[model samples]
Target chain A: MSGAGHHRNAELQARVNRLLDLAESRGVITRGQVDARIEAFGDRVTARNGADMVVRAWNSPEYRERLLADAGAAAAELGHAGGGYSSDIRLHAVANTPTVHHVVVCTLCSCYPLAWLGPPPAWYKSEAYRSRVVRDPRGVLREFGLVLPNSTEVRVWDASAEARYLVVPQRPPGAEELSEDAQRDLVTRDCLIGVAVPRLPAEVSR
Target chain B: MSFAVGDRVRVLTMNPPGHNRAPRYVRGHVGEVVRLVGDGRFPDESAVIGDAARREDIVTVAFAGPELWGPDSHTGDRVHVDLFVSYLEAVGERSDGGRTR
Candidate 1:
């Protein structure tokens, strides 16, 4: 089923590219402008920069406090806050501890924190995920292969309002020995989404 | 529309003709109001034809896993969902009781 879905998606993408080429030739929208727009959009919503903020917070307590208190300003301090549709949207940071974990979903539509995190993955927008995550969070997380202890609370942030949430995952043990750049590399998008925890060197290697 | 931070409220399942952000899983499920997030322009009527939604006061509701799922869920686990005002309907202490918010 997954393979078929990917094949269909690839075919649709080819069709879209063909349409885009025809549109550009017809002078409907310039290819240069479209390229520029895609670039601008990418810069505005890419999650790589947001991961940097999380890494910085992990290394610094002061920044973490600021980020938790006011995520929008904290992101702007790193020159990654405001963008295309972010003028009206606010970002919220939810920290995870040994006792708590955070995940985000949009039940109604695919409302996402595009400013901090780039466009959401296609899986995040799927009706199956969006419907099930809110109803059965643990089941959904388990499907992602994340099995939390019974004592750990799983917090699911619904991105319904103009606000978006970014999960601040707990720093793994032995991370203090690593450099800031190394630490940043461990903080993948899945970690920020609360599906997967940050890995140590051994875990990464395995 | 007006409830304390810890007040338990059930989300209404209204199939109105507009852009609503409430999820199907949470509709009719009771949860505690965790935070009284300030108002913003509502999104339901705005995103229909490309009009930007104005922000409205939205409350963050926290639900225990047992309440949402069943007793088989993790004991101490809870999920926090940010819900708009349109998605909620207040339930009192005398109402049908099952989940502790």
Candidate 2:
């Protein structure tokens, strides 16, 4: 069934399109300019760039250290910073260990690490998930079918400021033998977000 | 502008006029700043005017579960939230005590 929020968003989109059309007709805005703006918006946050950063951190300890020490520069080193809508937001990387895990959330709104991880999924923006995760992270993770061992410490990072965060999941065992490109393929978006760890070939086969 | 990394501060719950990055669930909670994350143009003013707002220092804050959820909350479990300078107030100086949740 159609929901009120969805309907409102559709109406807003229509209004924006009409305004754009009028602006174009009046010579105030060009179609090419509008297309460029739309393209910019889409390119503003990209997951592929983020995945590359994760892969680099996985392979280069120096880059990883720099990422942990100063995330903004680490991202800039790869040409992922300073995009539209993302100019103000900063990115941070958190490394996971055998005993600890990290997850990202935006309790108030859908702020995400677009520079490194791309746009957030629909589930990330839902009020149900947002409101519940901060209060009961383990229970919510359980709902996602991620049951953590009692000994594991689950750290939740609430992305509230213009600053955003990405999880640097530990490289899976046996990944050492794989080429960097192959290893990058293993660093999925979920791995970057700390929802799942990088899967080894054997694990993937299973 | 008012708080820095390592400073202990509490979130204010008042209805702020502009874009706010603070979560409602964490309003009135006390936390310690873990990292000074640099600054950015504030969102509130930027949204109104097409121009980028002036940059302010951003900080990463660490909050113990007990401070947010009382004594029954898991001991030693902590959460980190990145906050803008405007969303926070000094712990004892304000009378409202960040109650807006």
Candidate 3:
């Protein structure tokens, strides 16, 4: 299924269009408002915000301490406070240790860290991913091209509550030689989600 | 009842008639309290009563893969779930009907 609600079945599309029309006619909300909201989210709340946090944490131990303690406030300090429509939303940062790795999923629905990461990917909202990731995390990570050692423990986080999860992957070696902007580029969305780790340019070449 | 971090708790095996946040797979499984994830409005009650429901404590519980899915699961994998306190109970006391641990 498309994450942006595109290419759906015609019957479902028609029903959704009817509901939208009815709501617009009753002054519930306008199509323009909906478009504006999506645009705002795309522009302001993209995954780059999460990359920025990870990059900052990579450089500053103080900021990393603050982020792990109060993720919501730390995000807000960087101007990425993204609760959107609910005051109940909270962001939690789970750091990867030498023996432990963290990956997040929402089993019931597509609940994600939308405030910091903007919209979720199409695969994240799929039934196959939601059902299988918790059961066979290593298999799923393998499919994503991540092969962890048997000694390393995989921790699959099933997010069923209002709190959102962000994975803080270990910084790649030789990251200190790069500029801040360069470091940010290595911290991709996949790295932030813990499916893949950031790789230095030299490491990638090797 | 309140539980400190590192306490062992088991999820209640329940199939309630209304909306609930606890997933079916983790029901009746044992886990350790990893962190207290703050309180929020109870999903089951809030889904029925809307804004009038009371808030409840939430925690991040970590369960071994083998404990949840049996021996076929990965050897060193663990699953962490953010669950309401109401969905948990003393682990050893449930099946045996013995005194609370």
Candidate 4:
């Protein structure tokens, strides 16, 4: 970044630090709690958690059924309970089929399934993406290097409420041949957001 | 629940000057209630009255892409928006906010 931009960011960080100190001293919030939350977001809660659930669903039909029925309960079943600010928040998984593609966005704000998918990409919060995805999802996906066939049905989930969405990308060809760990590696954060799909290394050529 | 799954509902067009959860794009638009997402504290009033605001039902409304963006929207595409119960009414129901809210 430019020197001026770096200086501006440092100034903003110092202001946030002052606010944190004031909040801590006033007993409004504890430093330990703040640290724990940051730690959770940075490490404990991540897209790998979503990948774990997806891999389990791919391996077992019963688990997949359970996930679709009650995604919150299913996440807890896999020990990846959607933990964050509110217990009222619900996670809904939308699976991608050969003829159907499911993408998620919160037009008003970036209400993401962060507990499962980790932090949202910067572009997910951009005005261009937030507005256009709901309008021309297929076109935006094309920009993301995902070109769905004209016949495919695109479903854009606008998470304007408490219900957070997770896109269960279809396991790619040759994915079944890979081990469980290999399969999880394919399900990146983008895959979980429905911007892109998981693919085997060999399939990259297509 | 005021609305059941698969019911055709239309979002109310009333523009409350307070914090409204119903996005402008969906106001006065018609969609199908796909899921009954259990109620939460009503966001609009809660924004003004705080937590004391009554909890109300919310549902997933799936609108056809064409209905939202007209010709620019691709065929066979849809946008599903989660809307509070107060912001919706039965398709033929009068578009009066007082009746629902």
Candidate 5:
């Protein structure tokens, strides 16, 4: 479970361990608490939560309206109350249309929708991604293997405040015939982050 | 509370020594207000004052790539940042006076 194996930042790893040690020695927090929080993030809180919301919205027009209108409330409707972090941290869903695409980022820091979509990927927290995505979104999307058409407007959401964003990608073609669960399978974590779009099962293998 | 959706505004250019959430990339740039994300504890005050810090309204501002990064940026791309009210100032309308504000 430790990142010392291939994390590439031994100095930061040591510092984090030192801080955790200090907190433990001072009785501020027990190791069990830390492990529990990690386990929760690693297991209970995953992208499946966001996929559930996205899947529901795709199936029902009224739910889609509610999701776009008030994402936090709609998330709670599906049991993702988005609790734990500051109550002010609101979850907002931005749906990608045929002409407009949406990507989320936090230039100041990695302010992701952890409560609804689990922790962000490591690349998302890197300085390279943070700084470049805002300035050259199309280029970065290309690096992610997402080549949008010139006419498709890219909307990069820089989550600089407590407002966290969840990108609701439009359901891909050939997926409408699939069941709800199958459709949810197509909505991968990258799709939720907007770095990639959902692909049909057959397209994925190709 | 001061600005609404479609309001043309500019990010105040300042190098305040205090803690601020406004990123350096957005400072001094012009943008249009898009969404009003409800009030929350102002980060500048919260950094020094903690939970008791004064609250302020936060709004999402849409910045075109050209305005932030010049011509090399993709023509159809845009960045939307959620900035506090204190970090923005009214720039009235778009300079072109033709684009939808």
Candidate 6:
């Protein structure tokens, strides 16, 4: 016995349809263009773009200096030029050192570097992560299987503005023996976000 | 720009209507401008106007844990938030004194 008391879903659908029609009529965007853009984003952009930047920085001190200085330009050097959605948006890189760890979050909204890092993960957009990270970063990192020593300072970066953040995890031990591609594989999205650090496959196996 | 790098400033506790990028947590908090983050479209305006919004200067503000929270907070812990220039105010001697959150 379904009641007609609330047509919330239907009403929302109709509103969405109306907005789509209006946008199409005004040439704001076409369905084909939208689909094409999504497809391009899925195909060309991925976390690998960010991993490439990290791997390059880990190997080259000059690249690391440039990345820490002008992250947007450093990304562009690797052909990951962001700033499509907002003409003024920039990418900022924070490097993790022996004594400090950097983690990023957008408390107000999911203002991620989608152009460079691809779409944000489901967990990233969740309210728990958004609200909890700023309040209890160390606990959140610990829950994520990352336990930091008391001496290591945790720097929580609240990306509340247009500038997006990328965390460069500290280079792992014995990483010098790894090839460029192998090193790239070590740097995952979580490593870039500072929730987890890169580990050699052997380390994980052991 | 109203403030430069190394300038000690306080984030304005403004509750402007409509969209805003200044997070509620950092409002009225004292922090130092670490670096100029370049100019960007103001979120309060761009959140309404997609492409026509004017750009404004942005800076990465760093706040100590004890300052943002309290004495109970971790001693060496620091938090950094990128903020627009307009959201920051110049601090004078003892300007932040007697201003209780």
TM-score of chain B of each: 0.79, 0.78, 0.89, 0.86, 0.89, 0.89
lDDT of 1 by residue, A19-96 (tens): 999998898998789889889767666767778889989988999999999988999999986656545577889999
Q: i-RMS, every candidate?
A: 2.0, 1.6, 0.7, 0.7, 0.6, 1.1
Instruction: List, residue by residue over B1-101, the lDDT tens digit for candidate 6.
Output: 56788998898989998998888888899988898887888878988996688888989898888887788777677888999898988776665575633
Q: Give one digit per residue, the lDDT tens place, for model 5 in A1-206.
A: 11122555787889999999999999999999999989988987999999999999999999999999999999999998888858899999999999999999888988999887788787888788898889888888899999999999999999989899999999998888999999999888889999999999788789
> Best lDDT goes to which candidate?
5
Clash counts for the predictions, in order: 10, 3, 0, 0, 0, 0
lDDT of 3 by residue, A42-91 (tens): 79878899999988998999999999999999998999887657788789
The DockQ score of candidate 3 comes to 0.86
Docking class of 4: medium
Off by over 4 Å in 4: A1-11, A27-33, B93-101
Residue B53, candidate 6: alpha-carbon lDDT: 87
What's the CA error at residue B64 for candidate 6, in Å? 1.4
Off by over 4 Å in 3: A1-9, A202-206, B92-101
Q: TM-scores of all models?
A: 0.85, 0.81, 0.93, 0.91, 0.92, 0.87
Which of the CAPRI classes, incorrect, acceptable, medium or high, describes model 6? medium
Please give me the DockQ of candidate 4 compared with the native complex.
Answer: 0.78
- Report lDDT (Cα) of residue B91, candidate 2: 65
lDDT of 2 by residue, A1-206 (tens): 11125657888989999998899899998989988966865876556777778788888999999988878889889887745665666678888888887888888778887656766777888887777666666777777656778777778898877777888888888998999888888887777776677888788798
Error in Å for residue A60 of model 1: 1.8
Better of 4 and 6 by lDDT: 4
Please give me the total number of clashing residue pairs in predicted model 4.
Answer: 0
Choose 5 or 6, whichever is better by lDDT. Answer: 5
